[model samples]
Target: MHYIYLHGFASSPRSTKARDLSDRFAALDISLSIPDLNQNDFSHLTLSRQIQQVEALFPPAPAPVTLIGSSFGGLTAAWLGERHLQVDRLVLLAPAFGFLAHWLPRLGDQVEQWQTDGYLPVYHYSEAKELPLHYAFVADAAQYQEESIARSLPTLVLHGRHDDVIPLQASLDFARTRPWIKLVELDSDHALTDVSTEIWQAIQSFCAL
Candidate 1:
């Protein structure tokens, strides 16, 4: 069995959540693979490419793999679970569904400026730099706009009520639509701050699946 943790947008696998989870999973004798979704070019990141990269990481076998995705990575994991049959379970932390919609609005008038300028400056949490996101990123996400996870796998969603970025409602709507997906509301923000133990335990229990 493979244990993988997918990080969020602008965030890397070396994040506190990813490292702590990796350590906990290590103690359980489970190998966790947390790949950098940005790859080589943070300036031109796309979800589709990350999806393919993650798919390629797994060998051509029928081994069950559990996915632990955070924010943007959660969205990527959901896409993977929808396509691949080997994903046994999912543990999402504030997934960014309808991300384009949220992002465009957040940018407001800058959307036009970004489209005209061809790039938008955004902070990269992992790199600790204000990286420029190409306009192509938004266009790429549109390809999967109508796509959603219809699979009924054992899923656990941890969201924050104070999360203004992704909004807790998104997770609620997802869990509401799919009975198999369980949503947990935390008091923290979109970061799911100070909930490492809870997240680890949830992942471990879900790994038992």
Candidate 2:
């Protein structure tokens, strides 16, 4: 199976988890591919566009792909696994379902301001700059009803109990209906840094070759 890891929004393949996974994969003599989702301008970033970017990485009729996606990327993987039959397994870290529900409340009146301005300036840690995300992002994301997407693949979801970005309840709600999904709660926050070793072990055991 081919392995690929999708990093969170405003993050890159250089993230701590990405680097750690790469090193672990090397030790296991495996190749783990990580693509840059935000290679284009943030103004052009949307769920549809990001999904298309991931689609472009496939080698024609190649080995089955096992996906590891974090945050927004985790949501991306969830969508892809539903649509693509070649996806064998999924490991999601703080997958962002019902994310706008959480974000909109935080943005509050800024939602109206962003729609009026056409874009919102969000700080991108990797770029060290505030990037412009078009209001189209919110609209595009709304197109995909999270619960409607199919998720029959072998899946594991790791969510931080203290995650301030996306709520732990989102995963709990889904896992309740879909008992096949293994949801592991971590003591860490959205970063999931505190339980890195445990998460790594789970990944290794889940996709053991």
Candidate 3:
């Protein structure tokens, strides 16, 4: 089985959660591939582009793949699983369902300005500086629907009950009708950084790693 990890938006392969999981997987003598989703160009990031990039990293079929993603990356993984049968399982950490809806509204009137300017200055946690991301990012993300991700598989979603970024209701709604998905509500916030051990334990039990 091949294990691949995708980091959250504006985050990198070296994120706190990514490194924590990587170290845990290493202790088990397992190799985890965490790709840098930014690809050195945060200026032109799009959800479709992210899906394509991660798709290229997947090993050939029959190898059995497990995807572990955080936040926006988690949303990307869900779409990937829907499109590729090669994805055997998914571990979503606060997956950004209803991402555009939650984020766009926060921009308020600036949304129009971003469209006119063609870019928005968003703070990238990994880079430690605000980056000018093209408006295409929002446009591309709007094309994907959380409801359309209907692929049935062994999926585990760990969401924070107090999540303000992507409200817990988003995951609750997504998993409500999907019997294949197991939703575990954690006592943490959006980052879930404080409860890394709980997250890892759930992953081990669910994935049997």
- Give the per-residue Cα lDDT of candidate 1 at 203: 67
Across 72-177, the per-residue lDDT of candidate 3 in tens digits comes to: 9999999999999999999999999999899999999999999999999999999899999999999999888777778899999999999999999999999999
lDDT of 3 at 102: 93
lDDT of 1 by residue, 150-173 (tens): 888988899988998999988887
Q: Whole-model lDDT for model 3 versus the true structure? A: 0.94
TM for every model, in the order presented, reads: 0.95, 0.96, 0.99
Question: CA lDDT, every prediction?
Answer: 0.85, 0.88, 0.94
Scored against the true structure, residue 19 in model 2 reaches a CA lDDT of 91
Which portions of model 3 miss their true places by more than 4 Å?
none
Q: Give the residue spans of candidate 2 off by over 4 A.
A: none
Which sequence of candidate numbers ranks them by lDDT, best first? 3, 2, 1
Candidate 1's clash total is 0
Which of the numbered candidates is closest to the native, going by highest TM-score? Answer: 3
lDDT of 2 by residue, 33-103 (tens): 99988876766688898888888786567568989999999999999888888888999999998878888
